[model samples]
Target chain A: MNGGLRHILLALLLLTGLNPAHAAEPIKIGSFLSVTGPASFLGDPELKTLQMVVDEVNARGGVLGRPVQLIHYDTGGNASDALRYVKRLIRRDRVDLIVGGTTTGDTLAVIPEVEREGVPLISLAGAIEIIEPVKKWVFKVAHTDRMAAAKIYEDLNRRGLTRVALITGDGGFDKSGREQLRQLAPEYGIQIVADESYGNRDTDITTQLTKIRASDAQALINFGFGQAPAIVTRNVAQLGIDLPLYQSHGVASQTFIDLAGPAAEGVRLPAAALVVAEQLPDDDPQKPVLLSYKNRYEAQHGPVSTFGGHAYDGIMIALAAVERAGGTDKAKVRDEIEKTQSFVGTSGIFNMTPEDHMGLSLDAFKMVEVREGVWTLVENAD
Target chain B: MLEQLFQFLVTGITVGSLYALVGLGFALIYNASDVVNFAQGEFVMLGAMTAISLVAVGFPLPLAAVAAILITIGVGLALERFAIEPSLGASVVTTIIITIGAAIFLRGVALLIWGKDFHALPAFSGDAPIHLGGATLLPQSLWVMGATVLLVVLVRAFLNKTLLGKALLACSVNRAAAQLVGINVRVMLRLAYGLSAGLGAIAGILIAPITFSSYEAGIMLGLKGFCAAIIGGMGNPMGAVAGGLLLGVLEALGAGLISSGYKDAITFLFVLMVLFFEPTGLFGHKSADRV
Candidate 1:
């Protein structure tokens, strides 16, 4: 060979030799959460769990022997901010996968962007719309409002509570829950006698409660989160209503019990098994994963909530997909995520399919009631 | 039907008392400084948050409440001194804008101090509901009404009977004339802020048990209170009480009878009607522009 040809061949060999080992890029995961705004209660814990899991995965050599990079932006519970950050993550960060959204409103805001970008997104929001008419690139880990409503109605049915009163807040979650209850109550053989709604900032719901009390309702089902539910609890007590109160999974945090105080006692809600992890039977499939997550999380943070478990499941599912796909190729990863089945996660045993983005079923929730400010498993209710 | 009416009435009165209390705060600040201190609602939030924190730290409820009111008074004085006093000779719009800025600043400060969690104070008495015919009323409702009435009486007496109160009114009527008469207009303004803040704090503490208090609670309460102030003639204290109660009752009735979803809409609609028809308000004097 000529001298020039020999030198070019040598340089090409050197470049090819270095490329195999060093060319694997880190998998970028972006998240837009309401870490500082009204929905911080949900976002803060979720971000913590994501960070902890990412650190643990990286410590274990990450997926496919490549490091995972997490890019998190605080959406501040605002839909516009969520859309802005989602665009930024896709355009600027070039993230391979995304996981976030504390509220349904924010999650819905970013759906079009995530779909158009073809980046696989696992939303942490509980709205069913995040998954319904399932988009190719979108999935959710949080139990949907429909699932929660079904669980609540099932419990009500078991108790033979045929007549129910619904008091929902005027937020997105509450509105969706109200719609689900209205649509699904007939299926569960329950009649909603009085459906009332109060403003999210309303101080007193006595008038609503009074109307409910006078109705033919045998029980009160309050579908809301935040201080409004607590205020409703207080109002129910103040109105001397003697009916049973069923809350949605929205108020699954200890903060709800704290805000409601003595009034929170005997209030039952459908929550993920992570809430009563220690009380789970030894044979329960989710117990070990739930307990481990609970311990790891509480060792650093104060308490572990199911909201955080949603993030854990989202991250774990994404990691598992990357591992199964053997690379961070966006299409391959998205297909693997869709094929996820029987993956034990902090939220539940995820079984993602092409038709079902949220792999969780109604069985993922256990009926839990507050006893002396602590979540206790309702006996034989699940 | 009677029972429903009674329940709505009870709710209206309770909420009206709170609106009145907040409206009075607005009026007090408007009278002295000719600037509507939009931060009036923050005083309420501070009162409830401070009181809750104190109570959490094991102070008696009464003592915590007193300390909360005192701290809010200090905050009001500081706001007047730092924010209002510096812009004394500014245009009325400028002063009003400054007050709005002050409100935003106070809310941000509160968010940092208390975080974003909602807090509740135990009712001053207990949680028992008093059975009145077919309607049940919380004991705290009575406490709220009683406190509002007592404050109204005390303020009426103060404004009518005391020299300091007269100086405040004199400042409100004519700042230059009051200054000419040797009244310290600055002191009167400071006192107005202090009293207004204290009044707002009292409203916060009284309503916190019922409403629950969060860092952002001030915005809605302040807006509604401002509406009450406008409804009752902006500069009239007694008019504020009447306007507040009227607005509250109307809101409760609307919610109880009409769709609850349209509760706020109905309330604001009434305010719009009032503003369109009676530009000055129900109790406002029919006079030309003072300036």
Candidate 2:
């Protein structure tokens, strides 16, 4: 072969090896989470986690030898906002990979962009349906509503609680939670006595709780995240109902404890163990991951909240996949993430496989009961 | 069915009480100065935050509430003297723009001063639920309904029995004529703003316990108040009260009977229908002015 042909072949090999996706001056990673609006409670943490991952990676010398630059957009809890911001990040800002959004609806809203552009979107929110209907280049790092419901049912069965009364909010998120819980409750041999709902922003849940109080249900299942759950927690306490109150995964919020005040005690909920991260034993894998993230988070944003911790997990995993892929090749990174096993996540150890994007099982979570305005692990020594 | 109706009533009355309070401010300012203080919701936000902070700082509830009301009054009077007075007799639209600007400005200040998190508040009476005749309610709801009614009644008496209130009414009706009769119309307008803002503060504190107080809380409270006034009839206090209550009930019924997702849509649709069919509103009287 001629010398010129040899040189051309050598340069081509180098181009393929370098992975141009990560070589574009600065490897740009873009994300959209609700930094403002109703879902900010969830978005703020995910944004922080995204910030944490980027900072950590860049500090160690950027992903693929290019300094990692993160592009963040605030979706403001609006689906349109998610769509608009993602479009802006892709079309206007020209980011490499996107890795945010904290609700099923938000991730769903950005699915079109993820499809059209063939860019990987590692969503922090999970409705399960976001990827199930038609998965192109989307993956979730959080448990699905159905999965969470099944876990709750499993927990209830273990406790031998049979009758439940559901009081959820009237919103997309709450409605989804209610449906999933309802479908899964019968499987665990639990009967729902009464189901009631209030607006997402409704502060006063006395009437709803009163109905539940009068019902024959042994326990009340308050669904939905954000202010409504907190209101329910306080209302249940104030109304003086003695029935064991079981909250959906929605109560992982530290804001719930604050809003419920002393009323929060005795309310139990199933959550990924970050809420109990402080109580986890030293040398536990979950402890190191959660503590390191918490310390970094408190330094950057001040204090640690589990609601935000969920977001931190989503971003950390996505960045890891991007690093493994050595570039922003959407399909290659997604494949790498699918093969991720024993990857320590903020919520728990995530082990993704071909069948599941969210690899953590029910055992990965612990039931947390509110005590003294903080979530404590339920005293089930097992 | 009775239980359902009763529950809806409770929700409506609780929410409506807030609207009535805001509507009272609009009615007072409109009747006294022929202008709507668009920043009326800011007064509600200010009152709630001020009282909650004071209560948090170990101030007695009564003292904190009084301080909030007085501070709101001062704010109203100061706003009239400095901001609204300059635009006096300007086009109604111009005045509205000024109020909108003020509302946005006040919201910015609130976010800066109070931060964005919702603060917890204890109900005036501890959270023990009160059951009456097969219906259960929060004691705070009772206080809200009672406070709203009392304030409306007191405002009526003030307009009828007090010299200042009469002068304010006279000024709103005929500014030139009232001034010719040696009434200080500007001071009356200032008093109207003060009373309007003060009532908003009262509503804010009452509702704060029920709904956690936050920076952007008042804007929605104020918009609903505007709707309440429109429903009751502008320039009518009794109409405002009735309108606020009516709107709240409608919203509750819509939420319970229809789709909660479309609850807001139902309320706004009704407002549009009312505006289309009854421009002057049910209780509001028509007023004619020469150009």
Q: Highest lDDT: which candidate?
A: 1
DockQ list for all candidates: 0.64, 0.34
The per-model lDDT (C-alpha) reads 0.87, 0.79
Lowest summed lDDT window (length 10), candidate 2 chain B: B282-291
- In model 2, which residue pairs have backbone atoms overlapping below 3 Å? none
Candidate 1: which stretches are off by over 4 Å?
Answer: A1-25, A55-65, B287-291
Cα lDDT tens digits, model 2, B1-291, are 687668768777877877887888888888887777789989998899989889989999999999988988888788888888998778777887888888888888887777666776678988777876555667888888898889889988888789877888888788889999999977888888888889989988998887777878777788889899989988788889999999888887876666555677899998999899999877877776311
- What does candidate 1's lDDT look like per residue over B1-291, in tens digits? 789889988888878888888888898877676677788988988999999999999999999999999999999999999998998878888988988898889989988888777888988888878988887777888888887788878887888799988788778778999999999988998899999999999999998988889888898889889999999988778888989899888888888988788888999999999999987889976645432
Q: Write the per-residue lDDT of candidate 2 for residues A81-177, one digit (tens) a residue.
A: 8999999988888887788778788888889878888777778885878767547577777767777778677767778789989888876778898
Instruction: State the fraction of real interface contacts model 1 keeps.
Output: 0.67
Per-residue CA lDDT of model 1 for A1-382, tens digit only, reads 3566445534544654645455346789999999877788789899999999999988987766568999999988999999999999999999999998888889999999988889999999988888889899999998888888998888888888899999999888899899999999889998989999899887778877877877999999999888999989988887878889999999887878888878888999999888889999999988999989999999998778888999999999999888777666689899999999998887778888889998888788889999988999997663
The candidates score, on chain A by TM-score, as follows 0.93, 0.90
DockQ of 2: 0.34
**Alpha-carbon error at B90 in model 2, in Å?**
2.7
- Per model, how many backbone clashes are there? 0, 0
Candidate topping DockQ: 1
